[model samples]
Target: MANTKQAVPDTLPLLRDRIDSIDSQIQALINERAQCAQKVAEVKLAEQGGDAVVFYRPEREAQVLRRVMERNEGPLGNEEMAKIFRQIMSSCLALEKPMRIAFLGPEGTFTQQAALKHFGKSIVSAPMAAIDEVFREVESGAANYGVVPVENSTEGVVNHTLDSFRDSRLKICGEVEVRIHHHLLISPHSNADEVTHIYSHQQSLAQCRAWLDRYWPHAERVAVSSNAEAARLAAEAGKNGRAVAAIAGEVAGEMYGLMTVSANIEDRPDNTTRFLIVGNQEVPASGKDKTSLLISAKNEPGALYHLLEAFERHGVDMTRLETRPSLMSRWGYIFYIDFVGHYQEEGCQAAIAELRDRASEVKVLGSYPVAVL
Candidate 1:
């Protein structure tokens, strides 16, 4: 047989030329996509005929990310590949209208990280002191949406988040899960031996309890409002020649210009936190969706059983269930439930209807597309 295979180039110059060509093509295609997004915004404005046009659609973005993952054929992992597309979509959406997002933060917290992960870095992030403030920002139209932590894989539910949902009219439009990795950080001027006080958010402190006991048992643990605040305090203390350190994530450490004394200090390596996106608009069904509900059962015998039986009878899959003290009635509790399927679906609607009949009050918080990236 005649030799027909072409020899692969081993020269660096040839590889560089190929990469440059690919970059040029990628840039051109990205601009083309941006133009299309602009056209979509124009169409939306013309149809709505007002400034109230919704440029960002959570369901559409979720579908796009999911489709990208499904069609990806790569040596790169699904998440890494999806992230590239995420930045592209974020840039294109910015050409339409830059999205403003509020998150629980002092700017370097995990909630802020989740907002960037969900919306992409091409967004205006406003940091609020508390979760309720994040909700209020979205409710008052100061921000297009808000991101707040709902649950931690290690610590269970964030009760304050559930309580905020009890009275807020905002809906859960999307969700993002971030793996939590706490690090012990010290200022550039400080060292491990000089560190006396370890500062972090209460939850973070608890998360790293065992690690602390083993490493710095005698050091005083001080709980602060947020990890970023802890980082700020540590940095400030360093400037003053005080021996202090902070337990925070990489973002906070880098943001405050602190050095990592120890990395991944959390007791549980697999600790992860789930955050929810809250907004004023309702999200349409993205083929894969989840719905959250707030239900207050009658204070009587078998009240909880009656409320749960409806989902079992309808064959709906329940994902999480949490209870919080009711503000309306003393000694009473309200249930927060999350289940698979959109509220618009027949099975979910039937289950919700049955729940309403059995419970004293039922509120469909929102149906949102499942996290894709």
Candidate 2:
């Protein structure tokens, strides 16, 4: 046993040395790649002119991440490997030009997290107070892109986001899915046992309905503008000697300097939220892509059926279908649809043409690469 222990200790130093050597090589290669990215930027500037340069390509980035996953063969999982590559790509892209992303937030919100997750931490994030502001930021060229919550697995769709698309010319450039794990947080100055009021976003309150009912039925549930706002309110209340707790995610809790009283208190274990990246330009096909469209059928019988029949005939898989009231006319409905395949493809083009003929109006929001990371 002593000999075996001695052998293990001796091998550790050699293994660490090899790892250090590999790390040095990796660092050198990364810098070399960064230099290449800088050169690419110079070439693009010379060709496209300074004012019109676009450094980030959503389609290309998605393709690269997908290729990384496809070719990965390692002890590390595919997603773990892709994340490492994601940072590397993000750093390289920063060398070209840092991306500015707008998201719905007061900072420390899940939309902010989704923005970082989709665009990487290297981006400069601008927090907008409302979903429309996020869209406007991207539309007015103040931000390169915007991230907004589309739907949650437990809480259905974010109607605000759907409604924002009704008149917006901004396109869906990318998407990200983030797993949500809510935590019960108390301010550092407050006691968990003395909590009188619970604060959270209305959606979050609904998500943890059963859990809250089971554990703190007597506590007053206050719906705030956002989870981050709830955390801020809870932190302030704690300092003022009020027994208030916030239900929020880790980012908000940490940002507000609150202590976790209970972790992962969400009603469903697989709770996840989907966010969309909105930008001014339409993304080209990335091989595996999804297209979003807004269609309004004639206010008549079989209007909806005729609009959907084209996609079925073309074998285009429709992933999501949502109905929202049309702002153009009272009592009229518009269909927000998402389907697999890019608009540039033959199958999708044919399907869309048929829909345009059958429906009153058909607008292609965007065709973007599916989420890779």
Which predicted model would earn the best TM-score?
1
Model 1, 11: alpha-carbon shift in Å? 2.2
Q: Report the C-alpha lDDT of model 2 over 55-92, residue by residue, as the tens digit.
A: 88899999988998999887788999889888888999
Give lDDT: candidate 1, residue 264.
95
Cα-based TM-score, every candidate: 0.96, 0.96
Q: List pairs with backbone clashes in candidate 2.
A: none
Please estimate how well model 1 matches the true structure, expressed as its whole-model Cα lDDT.
0.91
- Error (Å) of candidate 1 at residue 302 is 0.5
In model 1, the worst 10-residue window by lDDT is: 1-10
Candidate 1 lDDT over 176-251, as tens digits, reads: 9999999999899877798889999999999999999998999999999999999999999999999799999999
